[model samples]
Target chain A: MELVGISKLNADYEAAMAVRKGIKLFIDESAKENFKKAGIEVAGTKVEMISDSQIVIDATPDGIGAKNKALYVSMKKPAIFQGGEDADVAEASFSALCNYDEAKGKNYVRVVSCNTTGMLRVICTLKNSFKVRKIRAVLIRRAADPREVKKGPINSILLNPVELPSHHAVDIKTVLKDLDILTMAYVVPTTLMHVHALTVQVDGNPSKEEIINALESSRRILGISKDSKIASTAEIVETFRDMGRIRYDVPEVVFFEDSIHSSNGEIFLTYAVHQESIVVPENIDAVRAMSGLKEKEESISLTDSTLGLLRGRLV
Target chain B: MELVGISKLNADYEAAMAVRKGIKLFIDESAKENFKKAGIEVAGTKVEMISDSQIVIDATPDGIGAKNKALYVSMKKPAIFQGGEDADVAEASFSALCNYDEAKGKNYVRVVSCNTTGMLRVICTLKNSFKVRKIRAVLIRRAADPREVKKGPINSILLNPVELPSHHAVDIKTVLKDLDILTMAYVVPTTLMHVHALTVQVDGNPSKEEIINALESSRRILGISKDSKIASTAEIVETFRDMGRIRYDVPEVVFFEDSIHSSNGEIFLTYAVHQESIVVPENIDAVRAMSGLKEKEESISLTDSTLGLLRGRLV
Candidate 1:
């Protein structure tokens, strides 16, 4: 499959593609000078590129994804909407670990948000090995991405919804219908990563080693011990940079191995989710599932391998 | 009682007392020019100030308080140490609501940290009305005070202690011995306030109204609803500024009434603790208790009233 990029904002489009490769790119002329300076040529706008693409990833800002749905539908192309879109805009609210089956061969699949994706991976990993009963999570959210200077909470903490069972839990339920979960979130003045304090209550007692082993076995979960000198989100990003990850993107959940505590059928742990990239692998897997190109495990493996999520320090 | 300020650093000493009045002062010449510009005169260093003082509030930086303990003892003066010092530095880790009796007439009393002071108010308030069996708190801590430019976690979240039962729970246990509590903390890039997601499990089921009324009756707990337009820490700080609070200090715990959730004998709620100011009233009450000036109820009332925490929008 060939990859194509389209955007009205040339600068944003150029910045995005500069980190990776895209064939047949289309963007406005706003960034033409910068592209010239960098010895890169730009292809002007092309609305007709949709006709050649099998699946479209509608990652436009929040509400715009819903508006773009009509264009994709008219072209008879499958599209994967982002978490920002309304759940009804797609066939399923997707998490590769939770509902790959539901998104398989579907016209549209909405990959859940960063926090939800991170929680689902842990819950699903445990559910596969135990009778998971209930879950409670406190999401310490980053105020904005490092590049979004216009965003804030610059010196404060915000209760985004100012209520219990923040929308994250509701969004997760859309993908894992029968799972019991509750979430609380506080938006802090940090642009790096989100930290989740999760408690999973199961039916019977599970040893800490068993739970740790299960989480370790998951390709998308990166466990780092306290002694590893990678304690905070800052260190995690630096580690990714040291490993030569483009844009210092950490696609896997950074689970603190020392934080794992289990007793009386309850498991408690803390993990950091790189909001910018945790959903990338899920988005790639969604495309594969929706296009009927591969089965669940195979699609996940392929996506993980392509993203280098299954190799090096991430493993 | 006369108040005297003493600091080796004149700038910090001047900054602290400029907001209030002190009969005698001591500091270096670092802030002499600024003090002159403000029409304020700074007295030279006075190491002998402790001789005439009955009770000294040793607000020195963390370990410094423990070291200063020697001087206080040498002068035979009663002193109040801050949370930074270990619990052993004082007669009791003092929380006015938790163990005022233990600190009364003591030579030294250590008021707990801002987060601990905030949590103890809520937990103690609930424990007064219910049999608080266990408590689990997730402390979303501010990275530093707004003035501490050198402190950071500027773009990342640091899991302080990177372990369970962060020192906060251990500190609380020092005062309320035999109380079952567990706390987790993450330091985020915010200098305004610390937000806590607290879960209190009691013996018998209590109605939401009962819990709300119990919290509302506490002088140190200020309840704000979601519709009150004081949802986040930024709004809370802005409101305090509009209220004409000195340095925008909020000495009370700003409890989000809308975040209160009660079910199956468990009470869940979220609150914001202004890190710079939440410990102020606690320090005042510690002074009264340490100097044997007033009983718990009377001292708390005096401190709350003097700090204006009992008036205006706070009520």
Candidate 2:
């Protein structure tokens, strides 16, 4: 694994820096001096890194992945793109819960954005248990990462399009082609977590216990504190800190057991996705799926266990 | 406006103490000394408080309200009861959003609880804008009020029935006779707020803007900050603090403008009801309704304005 960047991050990059091994920085000449000064080793250029690696995860700034497609094509190696990249850069959008098969035997897979992944994790978990008639999701997104201090309208709330369905519904359709989804997206000032409030209308009446059981069955969904002790995302981050997570990152979807409500056939609930680590597991699973080294179930299970997804309470 | 209580509270009672006028404590001999020592004047027995007032608002504990009905009955004064009282104790349950008119000329009115009020606010707001076919709500309730440290399983999540459709649906029907609602209740350890996640299946495909406009039309609904600055409820409380609210209480339902998502007649979103202040506005409206001094519109408007409910962001 290699950490490839075009230049030195405007500020310290904690998420990338937290990786202690199997990571060599492939940065430009301008960033090389800063890397060495910071007591970090630097690898060759982006072109050399692409050729040397078995798999490339293009996590560069938005639109940059599409620009670097030629290098990956030259190597004929499997590459994964982050949400910031357009779907055109890859054959199909990837969500571990939505379309694992799409990633198999593929050279390019674009992992869906953080918000979309959270919605997929939830909708996919319950879709099999109940007949989903419709889905409406509200994405309360973080305006900027904690480190990106200069990036936002810190006081005002901006609604994208001031309309019904935002790009999220369109992005979700890239994988869940048949499902009907309407997404409303808003970027808030908070840099902590992105919260998705979802309502899925399913056919027939499902019991609350039934809905809880269905979600609990999913290994990827980690049930966080339902007890009020950890009420807000700030407290939730603190819980992760107290749990002694290496980078204080919760890669899995965190939901409240008490928040699960099923009435008649409709389900309503709220869940938080850590913008920093939600895609990390999907990236690992995509590697296995793209390499064709293991089956979907084995790959997902291996990713979940290795990532400590099962450490939290189930319900 | 009367602060008639059985005794001096063991802990600080911010809500009650915040009232500037028209409060009299009615406590027994045991706690009467504490009230006088705290420089508070004491009224006579429960019977005197019920008899002397033009209208009585019974803030007594559960079962105790039923027991004290004899006192209110003797005076024939219209009394408002909290949710803790049984249905038999009151003629009908009261929510400002639901059955406000029913409170008129009623001898006994029961104001719904905090969690119920939050759901009712959202449901009533939407029901008017769209034909609601079905509703499912999950109540992430506060285990105990901030003042009631003695009353809770503070570290554990408790499912009241360990099944579907807890008492909230049954209670909702007591006010809304035709609503098809199912509510699941769970108590979390946090004392800050009770969060309600609601999903409604409506008759037509409504746009997100239409749904948001409906809620914003209601003065009691306060759209809070969505940007990174005020991410958590802790910060929301601080926002109220900076605004110089009397009790640091948010009497209105705090939701996000970006959280309104509607597609194919289904709407989804999450909002937090400050457990300390949610019922306060309802209680105020209930008094006006019970006393028959004003119509429903005037009563609700007067309550909202007097409580500064219109001060927060509308959208």
Candidate 3:
């Protein structure tokens, strides 16, 4: 994601030529030329034809761009729209997997930030449940912006990411119909995980255990587990290193919190995402959805295919 | 807490003169000013002169602030250093039967943030049974400097809060010395709950359920319950208001991170606390030390009355 995020597609000859040979995610013409020289299977029409399987991730600077139209037309079989930054994910939006049904033809669904997806899964799980009186999500992001990384000051850092909380709140509502709900997002410069310290004050006084159990029982696609708490920063780093040694086939994306401290006693615990492997989620999830796996079947799919295939190739 | 945070006893005013009128809690003073002209007493040395059954809160700032050193001996009982910001909780920290015990005999101890207390409890519980490996805490702060209240960049807003992973972790170890571990902490500028999305990769791969139960079974200081994966921002606000309606006692110190996103397929949970209400555990293990009230009737020495009082208070 940051590969394309750092800069726009360069149209120059070198960048185009280096496209194919250098890497595969997003290759420009110059880079493509480089790939052609390297003799990689530079398939597809060179005329920049956005064909089927040609997903146009709506990272076009616009928070919400006109990529849905592109998907409606180009998705001859099963196309996708990776809604990166500010793209809205409404209940009616294909991105809302709970409402997602069998597509008559090719379909276009958006995958917003890792933070939004995480928030959505949690909210939607309890949306219809009358237990909750209200819900709020703070999309705490990483310090390094893939598209463009620029350091900002702190006070402004805590500022809500959404220009208008109402619409975005609805965006959360479309998926999570809890009438009494709101969404607040902030971008912090820590890249271990996108910490979303949500506060849920239910209509009735429910036991904390009951609420936590409800969350733990949620789907794996949401990738949440009771095991992940606001981990200590040292533990977070240790977990990151542990993943490599344990060599888990699954791209075990460990979750931890920005759960840190202050002498002032202000509690700020946001989630963390390993900036290096952030895209690991998108790939695994995309493959799972593309492979036609059900909500819970994704794990099996990964075991039988996704992780297996990757491991096999590595060996 | 902000009152103590901002201003200090001016040197211009005679030291005894400042005491003659009586010590007043920040909020008490504010109330006297706002509601009526009856200026109230803050940290008055009522140990020897108590006409009313008033609450004598140990809202003193940090450790050093609590100790009555010879340098400040002229003052009856050294003024308990407290960030007057806690004037918000002045009513509760002192008023209610909140069983909080602080070392009052010329020593220092911390009344931590709720998250700080919760994290300390969580880690200590884990360390008691499991072979500890590492600990880390990433804290997102409100405003590093209380002065800057406006929206600002994430960088400037972040602070490495002191007394986290350390004061709590070490304090726990001081009593429960079963394992060796390392810790780290970072602070960001988001307020409310110090949402901690933690992950404990034990010495071996413990079943997820085992880990959850181990956590839930921990000490009673912090409530460790399960939660849903997604909680919109609205839920958070409503929860706050709801907590207000319930009139949660102890100033309802913590915020719940009902939605700490794990991943496309992960798990996360979190909790928060009002740092001050937390009792610094007796060196670490207060239960074993507080056995005086136990049915066994263990004859425990009452060397540290603060610890004894706390031990006596432990339920």
Candidate 4:
């Protein structure tokens, strides 16, 4: 499959291509001359870029995706929307592990938010092996992304909704229809990652080893042991940087192996979710499902392998 | 009661008195000359300060309290220890609201830690009006005191104990002997306050107003309404500073009035504990309890009045 970028802004298009593989093409001599004068080569955009592409990934800012959906629908093109878009903006809220089949051949698929995506991977992975009952999660959320200067709590922990079961849990229920889950969230001063303290109850009593094995087997979950010395999100990002991960992006859900504790059919564990990149792989899989190009496992494996995720201890 | 500062270091003595009300007295000419040359009339410590004092407040560092126990015991002085000391170091681990009776007339009374003190005030207050069966609290802790530059996760949310029921719960249990409570803690990048998300199971189905009334009636717990516009820890400190509070200290537990929700014998609420000063009132009460100067209610009322706590909406 070929990839192309389209944005009203030339800089946005350039940024899109820089993160992926694409040839820098100049649309006009003026555009080329502008870059030459600045002593830098640049990429350019075309008016018919959307028309030329088979599918569109509406990666625009939040409400913008809903607006762009009209254009995509008018063109009769299948589009995948980011988590920012509301559920009504898409035919279905997508999670590759939870409901990839629901997105197959659909015109619009909205991959749930980063936290929702991270949770789906773990919950769905567990559901695949056990009769899951209920879950209570306390989300210690990052106040802002590292690049975000305007957004803040700066040195405060704010209750995101100041209420019970933040939107992420409700969002999860959008896909996993009957799952019993409740989430409480607090936004803390950190841009690295969001940490979740989860307590799950299942039908059968499972050993800690069995639970760990089930989670570890998932290509999208990276089980980190205590001995790794990659204790906090800072060390996780530092390890990713040391390992030469692009943008220090850890697309996989980081599960602390030592944090797993199971007793009397109840399991307790904690994991860190990279809010920026946890949904990237899900978006890739969503693209495949929307295009009807591959089966669920096939798409997930392809995306994981392409992104070099779950390649053992990241440290 | 007369207060005397007794620290081997004059600087430590000065800092202690600066926060409290005491006249600066120089013990030696050299010390007086040194302060005069520095353009400051500083308080000096006498070698006989401990012997001359009726009671001692051991504010030394953690294990140092245990070591200092030997000296206090040798001096035959009734002393009240800070939370830093172990339970074994004192005759009782005390929270004014929880175990003031047990601490009464005791020579060595250890005021529980800041977090424990915060929990005890709320729990004991609730236990006063209702039979609390169980409690599960998620403690979002401040990484360090604002004045401490040496301590940090800086930009990370660390699981204080990468396990369930962090030390705070265990510490709380030390005082509330048979109270069933489970606590989880994450240390975030904030030095202002520790936010607690508490879900308490009670024997009776109390109305939200009843619960709020019980909590507010406690002089040590300050109920903050949403209308006050004090949303997070930063705003709480700012409001205190605006109120001309000494050192911007909020010695009361700041409970969010709007965060309280009651359903089917369960109470869910969130409150902020100013880690620096939440225990100040408790410490004052502890001194009175240890010295047998006042009974439980009398000591608490006196301390609350002296600290100017629970006056009204701080904002």
TM-scores (chain A) of the candidates: 0.91, 0.90, 0.59, 0.90
Error of 2 at A8 (Å): 7.7
lDDT of residue B142 for candidate 1 = 86
What lDDT tens digits, residue by residue, belong to model 2 across residues B1-315? 554443334313542463235555565556656655666666665556655677777777778878778877877777788887777788889888877898888888898877777778878888787889887665656666767859754433344433357788887877788988877665544566666656688998988667767777876787654453443455566678887987688888877655556666767666778877888889888888877778888888888777778634632
Name the 10 consecutive residues with the lowest summed lDDT in model 2 chain A: A2-11
Ranked by lDDT, the better of candidates 2 and 4 is 4
Q: Taking the tens digit of each residue's C-alpha lDDT, what string does model 4 give over A72-181?
A: 88887888898888888988999988899999888888999999999998999999999999887888999999888798888887877665768888999989989878
Stretches off by above 4 angstroms in model 4 are: A6-47, A311-315, B6-21, B24-47, B311-315
Q: Which candidate order results from sorting by lDDT in descending order?
A: 1, 4, 2, 3
Q: Which model scores highest in lDDT?
A: 1
lDDT of 3 by residue, A127-176 (tens): 44435555444445555543343653222233243222424465555444
Q: What's the chain B TM-score of candidate 3?
A: 0.48
Docking class of 3: incorrect
Clashes of each: 0, 13, 112, 0
Q: Top DockQ: which candidate number?
A: 1
Q: Give the TM-scores of the predictions, in the order they appear.
A: 0.91, 0.69, 0.44, 0.91
Considering summed lDDT, which 10 consecutive residues are worst modelled in model 4 chain A?
A: A6-15
Model 1, runs deviating above 4 Å = A4-22, A27-47, A311-315, B4-22, B27-47, B311-315
TM-score of chain B of 4: 0.90
